[model samples]
Target: MAEAARLLAQLIAIPSPSGAEGEILAFLEGWLRARGFPVAAFPVPGHPWPNLVVNPQPRPRLLIDVHVDTVPPQGGAGPVGPVERDGMLYGLGSADAKGGLVAVLLAVEALGAGQLADSPITLALTVDEENRGRGAEALARGCRPEMVVAVEPTGLTIGVAEAGTLELALEVRGRAAHGSVVEGGRNAIREALGLLRDLEALPVMRAEHPRIGQGAVTPLFIQGGERALVIPERCLLHLDLRWLPGIPRDRFLQEIAGVLARYPVAWEIVDLSAPFETPEEAPLVQAMARALETVGLPAIQSGMPSWTDAEPFARFGAQAVVFGPGDLSLAHTPAEHIALAEILQAARVFQHLLEAFARP
Candidate 1:
């Protein structure tokens, strides 16, 4: 428990905000190597955000994956310098993901110490789950896991499905005119508002998934117009679409096209991630449930509304489950923290699974 707490604290102290996870990657590499695990670093493009691959021998029967990168720290929490209080560890990435990563490593260490090294378990820690899922995407394009368990903060629940993400960049173009002749020119802001109205009227959003339930869309940001003296010529609106499994990317794009055509506007999908789900009764999910139950934690299958890297695995047809410590609510908040008890619980649960699968 101490080791896990220490490791998590050190990791959070490193400031691995998304797009800048190199330092944390190196830290994890050295930490795992010191424990006799072989570490390999996968090169990430455009930034030092490398992914750490920790492999121990005996052929991995289970693959544990976690994201090392976190959402950019809002100014509220200056730096996640570890703080321990009331048996909880508080920091920036504490709940969001660093804690989960710590639990995986600790579990692997425990299994190794018990001479259960024969169990097939590989820890693939990725970068960029907060912004773009490039790290997870890279893994999907490269290796295949027999059973994938994404160790995100699930409060120790067995996660079966996750909502996917789509980022829309809508641009409204209008004829710019001097402020004195504002009435003579079309205002892009007005055009953009019309487009938003159309989007708000979309009934395509289903309220629930078969297992996950209810998808949502939110207009995250908007920007346009340099000065009040002139009629704005352009406005850009960014929409975040949280979709369920049944919605196809093409269909979503079609709907966007249909909405934009009614106005003098152009739009493009700046980023897209498809919704993914695995059946609750899937073999991989069953294995995870069994593992959790063996560790004395009653396992109940659940779903998350937020997006995770697990979607990419589902897209590639890998039966994946999200399981780990920490609460989803604490992920990026100023009060971000993970209960020490949960960390210990998660480590033991993972160790139990390793022992169970090591035999056969």
Candidate 2:
């Protein structure tokens, strides 16, 4: 518990925003090196920062992945206050990720302290996951793991699958005119509103997978218009759609087109992140379940609501699951925080898993 708390405090004190994670990586590399772990920093092209990759001695690597960079702090945001209330740690990045990062580190430290059998665990702490998955993508190109345990905030649940992600930018264009001559111009705001109405009415079919379960869609972000008096020339609306596995990217795009066809508005699918599903009964899942049991925690399973590096790992034919402590709901919020107890529990869980799975 003390180790987990110390590591979490060290991680949160460092400011490692999505595009800037060099200092944090350097700290982690140094920390691991002092403990006799071989560490390498994989550089990302066009970005000054690089991902930290640590490998302890032994064969048959198990990659424990966690993102180091956080969503950029808003202006006026200051250092996180470390408050211990009822055994929980209240601070920025305490729950979303830095907690998971500490958990993995402490778990490894525990193994070394106890002289337990160590299987090679590659700790890939990458950057830019909040904005994009470039770090995960870049690392995937070089390192392959027998199994990947993506340390996401899953409240300690074994997350076997995550729904797919699609980024939609709905644009509406109209002639700008004086407010007094309202009828003389086509209002882009009105067109955008109409498009939104149509989108709300569009039927997104439900999806089912053997392990990932059903899929649903939700509207997340919207932006449009500039002036109150003038008819705006343009508006943009963005939506995030979660699709189930086996749903082709083209099919998802087609559905978006079908929705926008109801209105005379310009729309495009700007980006798409493929969804992933791994069988709950797979060997990797069973191993994780057994490990959780050994730590006296129930082996609960659930589906992830957002995207992660798990999708890219699935592309490489590795059974990946999102499992860690903290409530994901706390991610990126001003009041974001996590319990120290949860961090300690996660460390124990990982320790049990790594030791038990060392042979395989």
Q: Which candidate comes out best when scored by TM-score?
A: 1
How far is 260's C-alpha from truth in model 2 (Å)?
2.7
Which residue pairs in candidate 1 collide?
Answer: 60-120, 60-121, 61-120, 207-214, 208-214, 209-213, 209-214
What is the lDDT of every predicted structure here? Answer: 0.78, 0.76
> Cα deviation of 309 in candidate 2 (Å)?
1.7
Q: Lowest summed-lDDT stretch of 10 residues in model 1?
A: 54-63
Q: Write the per-residue lDDT of candidate 2 for residues 1-360, one digit (tens) a residue.
A: 676777777888888888778788888888887887677778776667888876632223578889888887765453475555677776777887889988888887767722433455667787778777888887776776768888989999999878777777777788888877989988887887776666545444465665555555555666666757887777777777667777777776687688777665776776687777778888878988988888789999887878887777778777889998999887777777888888888988898887765554
Q: Candidate 1: where are CA atoms >4 Å away?
A: 45-49, 56-61, 77-79, 113-117, 177-183, 210-213, 226-230
Model 2 RMSD, rounded to 1 decimal: 3.1
Q: Pick the candidate with the highest lDDT.
A: 1
- The true-versus-predicted C-alpha distance at residue 202 of model 2, in Å, is 3.2
Report the C-alpha lDDT of model 1 over 1-360, residue by residue, as the tens digit. 687778888888898888888788888778777877778776656555667876633225567789988887777744465898888898898988888887777878877733544456667888887877888787766766667888888889888878777778888899899878978888898888888777756655645686676656687888988757888999888888777777777787677678878888787878777777777777777777888888788887777777787877767777788888999987778888999889988888887776666665
**What C-alpha lDDT, on a 0 to 100 scale, does residue 269 get in candidate 2?**
70
Give all TM-scores, in the order shown.
Answer: 0.89, 0.88
- What value does the lDDT take at residue 247 in candidate 2? 76
Error of 2 at 141 (Å): 1.4
